[model samples]
Target: MSRFIAFFALVGLIGFALPRSAASQDWQLTDANTFAPANYLILTIPQDEPQALAALADTLAADFGVSLAAEWSLNALEVHCFVFDARNVSDVDGLITAMETDARIRTVQRLRSFSLTEMFHSDPLLPLQWALQSMRVLPIHASSLGEGVRVGIVDSAIDNHHPDLADQMVDLFDFVAADPVPLAEAHGTAVAGIIGAAATNEGIVGVAPSADMVGLRACWQQDGAPGVCNSFSLARAINFAILNDIDVLNLSIGGPEDPLLTELINVALEAGIVVVAASGEGQELVYPASLDGVIAAGQVAGRSVPAPMVDVLTTAPGSAHRYVSGSSIATAHVSGVVALMLSQDPTLTSAAISERLNGSISDVETLPMLNACTAILGPSEACAL
Candidate 1:
């Protein structure tokens, strides 16, 4: 575990107040340049060989024109992963192929980008929140407030000062900026509001108002554009969640399948952390959600491919709220339900929670609705009543 200690030391303080190494600052600026998939490639080398790793990085720089942008030691996977900023887009495919044949390299992958599963809509009647009625959230709240459960909201920066989330946020970390005081963004604030915003008379209430929420800003939003994240940033946040003893992780983002991200997610699952993610837009489930031992959730009203749909009303940045719809928003509600169950029992596995939710789905709604009351308090408390 000494290597794990070294890993954390390299990551800086506990709340991910990372002191960026020279290499890290380079990619931060590169990723900052545009939200489009970063021109970076991910590869891994053996652990405990700093000299060998540096030499390999130099060899790649000399042999292929790519330079190390950032590196993190994945203790659980027993490999040190590196993200290289390719000078040319053409160099990426060739570099990955060339690296695969090297004895020093354990694995190599092209970086994949991901985005939040939410779309914002303006509707005056959204304050009524029909989705709450569909889920029977009020009755479900009678049995559980998700008291004391720690849920990691792995998305954009949440507005910690938003009235709904002010008292609920336990911690905040910005992997995008490597700063503790991350700027509030719409997507993350909305997800936090849905999962565990403080219940108040003035604003909309969350599904599990009493759960402890940790705002982890892995995805970044620029100029009101949708929030986006790449494999390097996602892996860091997931690894932080796994090592920090976070009880539940809410990932409302999706992308193509990634090996490094998958390894980190599997580690979290094996450690008894329940991971909930948004289901895919098409017929298949996306990465992270697509992985085994993860709970895949989609909108109760169905996805928004062929039709424009209204989803849930939740918190937004700066003392506001909005109606957001998508498998992304749906994942938040499901995560809140999991918090409710965990708050009561504290031992439910992802599989058990999934089974409970599936068994309790209501047939009354044209589209299947999660019977939150029955899911939390058992079949006798079915929402059909």
Candidate 2:
């Protein structure tokens, strides 16, 4: 298994060079601040003569008073993407309005960012989690500890060295800063703890304790603030997950409708990778979750698991353990259960898995929650209710 530190060093040493734009500016391959607001715009220009493209960049820079931050060509798509940073943040709308009229530009829009769905909470540990018992996790684990299953966490940076997560992590990719071991944050670390934390005697056991985890950091977090992720970083991470053949992808975040991200997730689903996401707060579902083929998890005391598992322990940054709440954590629990199902029967399709999970819910009022043991073994073979 490759550690995040090794990947970070390798990224630094073997950095790939980007083509300079016609404006005579070197392309900015990675953003210095991933979570910052939309001071930048993504412009799609038709592929043309190098001089023509350069002249266009120069003209745009001069007219709009913007600077080219990054530029890349998609030869197959016959287009070039140019990222420009506006000198005046407030001028973004004006610039977009003016650029939309230019005949040469294919598409232009201000970059959009997404966010984690979890709410942070810290408290003293309670020995047993109600969720674990409710789901009959132990009985399912008797057959499979999610061995050989890979769960991709597409969220904020995770604590790579946390005692509960250190050994469960199989890989790490930081689209946020491109660091090998992305900066750890509260949300991702907690979500990861819910899904794949190690079953060490000292800490809380995770839903799929032995499953493999790949922390793809598309989001960043600041102290005492919610984690944030933009479309470009998230698209890159999801593309990576698809290319790498991840078994199950957990998206413990929510955002508005986005065409680019929707398509990437669609491709992943079509490729037979199970994609799970938090259903946004309220009655309506968010993008990706609202899109077809995704298991939308909600926190209604329920396609979801129990919320406020007061005893549901999760890992936090700085190697600390704490309790967390929200639809994001519920999504993680579902992802973990999926991992367990996949481990036992790698051939199960996403639909079949969903049916088994929903069908196995033990009657607990109108609120439906997962029953892992019954989902894995037939209800007849499952542990007695």
Candidate 3:
């Protein structure tokens, strides 16, 4: 029940204090304008002396008008500098040259800022028909549709006005605004489409075509961002879903573990609702997905590769088809599959549903490439454990 503003304020107050191990390297800003709109510059410095690195960082920060954002100790040395102005780009180059000349700096690279769109469009899903036929998975034909289940989509608010989803949207709740629409990132719309978009020929079909949708805008809008949600608002949205008795909850956003959110998820599970969460893109597992009782889904590229420990493919708005991979998209697929299972039997408890899912997996033997359909449909008796 903690409020959003208070939580964010608390995180802000912590300021930028790099962990002890990361404080070893001195990262100097060379040129700021090299990156437009300000991007992170990564520097790898020698790690022979820790105190020297910290002192160097302090001196560089004073010499150049840049701030030390973060640092990590890895194979060599890692430092991130936040550039405030474009004019510093030239300064950054000069700084790099000076460091390289001094023999301390090993390498410097600009951290590329990637868009969700670029990530998704780079790889697309195999045609649904091909996936079903080749994988020998259950066909998501009109016959296996999720007719009576309700899925609560917690993310940016949906357009509801979009042509494909306009009529399928059932209810709306905006946890971010004084009103019911979200203005952050179109994240909700994209997630919602992945879960239950109607079967319109203009775009790709959702995993659960017949399921009803409940759009909850729990993320606060960032300035100038059109469709993104924040963590605090997300916690509120989860509570709202439980109170409203949503059958399935699809959470695509995650962050560090929040004790408050964890408690809420336990309560919802006890109430018999199935929660599906994304495991995040990197090696680290994000919360809600990592928590007990939540199905942590990882992304897969196509039918060919093993389920990606980090990516998934689904529908995006317009006529575009993108890989849309993330723990978020993977969570939606799990939610859709859960809806399909629920449609098979509405009375199944959350625990029972989870058991069936874990017990029936086809690729559980393979560590990470486990497919859900194989999990739910169970392999032949010869493959049974």
Q: lDDT scores for all predictions? A: 0.73, 0.75, 0.59
Worst 10 residues of 3 by lDDT: 115-124
Higher-scoring candidate on TM-score, 2 or 3: 2
Clashes of each: 0, 1, 28
User: Deviation in angstroms for 241 in model 3?
Assistant: 0.8
Worst 10 residues of 2 by lDDT: 2-11
Which residue window of length 10 is worst by lDDT in model 1? 1-10
TM-score of each: 0.64, 0.64, 0.56
Residues 1-385, candidate 2, lDDT per residue (tens digit)? 2111111111121133333334343444554344233687878898765767778888988887888776667555667777788746577788899889988789998755432211111112313556766676766765788999999999988898898889998888888784354367899899998897776445667889889999999988887699899999999999999999899999988887888998899999999999988876666677677777888776543334332333467889888987777778878988998999999999999889877876777654455666777888876423444
Candidate number with the higher lDDT (1 or 2): 2
Candidate 1 local distance difference test against the native: 0.73
Instruction: Please list the residue runs of candidate 1 whose C-alpha ends up more than 4 Å from where it truly belongs after superposition.
Output: 1-127, 179-182, 299-309
- lDDT per residue, candidate 1, 79-156, as tens digits? 666777785657567777888998878998766543221112122332476666667676666567889799999999
Q: Against the true structure, whose lDDT is highest?
A: 2
Question: What's the true lDDT of residue 16 in model 2?
Answer: 32
Residue 296 miss distance in model 1 (angstroms): 0.3
Q: How far off is model 2, as Cα RMSD?
A: 23.7
